[model samples]
Target: MFVLNTFDIGECLSFLCFISVSLIFCFFMLFASSVLGGKSLSRYKHTPFESGIDPVGDTSLHFSIKFYLVAMFFVIFDVESLYLYVWSVSIIETAWKGFIEAFIFILFLLLSLFYLIRIKALNWVHK
Candidate 1:
């Protein structure tokens, strides 16, 4: 003989609640921005320079390719690690499927990384 309580016995700080709250916040921000900002779109709305000031520059700035490569690599690996964190959380419930899925995902990620290395995408030393 068991009696169920009115309060939730299973809800333990749901991550879905956080997601929903953040979405609501985003919607409010969008609505507020649109309402308060007003519709002031005109021809000169986004002109970078003012007063016809001639842009004084050599216009020949070349960025180091290494800088961009590092940034992109960081982003790729960072996203992969983020997914890893999420996968870890549900690994217990999902069991074998979760293990196989995460394993294959990591395997593919490593393959891509290996491919990048083989292509020398990270090699930035200028000869």
Candidate 2:
């Protein structure tokens, strides 16, 4: 039961046109590359090359648990920062209630960080 107005229809048409043009450009570039790019069947072409030197040993490296823990912490904090940014931007609309909610959110983040520190979860080396 939703109806779109003339302005909405115009916007939809423009969006469709933009998508069509983008797809056409992408396909054209792909086709041109396949046609114009060099085709090599040389033995060294498939080998992994790094810093102008031939790659030796396994390319895959095993990472420590600390690396993953730090990465997870970074991602968690990054997402929390995004939420805080949005809340800060819409402060006027949110007013006092939003301020309280954001305060609580920040408090929880600090508590969690402290908990991680107490548990030695953020420590780089195992004892």
The candidate scoring highest on lDDT is: 2
**Model 1 alpha-carbon drift over 4 Å, by segment:** 1-61
**TM-scores of all candidate predictions against the true structure:** 0.52, 0.77
Model 2, poorest ten-residue lDDT window?
1-10
Candidate 1's residue-wise lDDT over 52-75, tens digit each? 875576757999878888998999
Query: In candidate 2, how many Å is residue 8 off?
Result: 1.4
**For model 1, where is the 10-residue window of minimal lDDT?**
1-10
**Candidate 1 accuracy as lDDT:** 0.85
Quote the positional error of residue 105 for candidate 2 in Å.
2.2
Tell how far residue 57 is off in model 1, in angstroms: 7.8
C-alpha lDDT values of all predictions: 0.85, 0.93
Q: What is the C-alpha RMSD of each candidate to the true structure, in Å?
A: 8.0, 3.8
| Model 2 lDDT, residue 95, Cα | 100
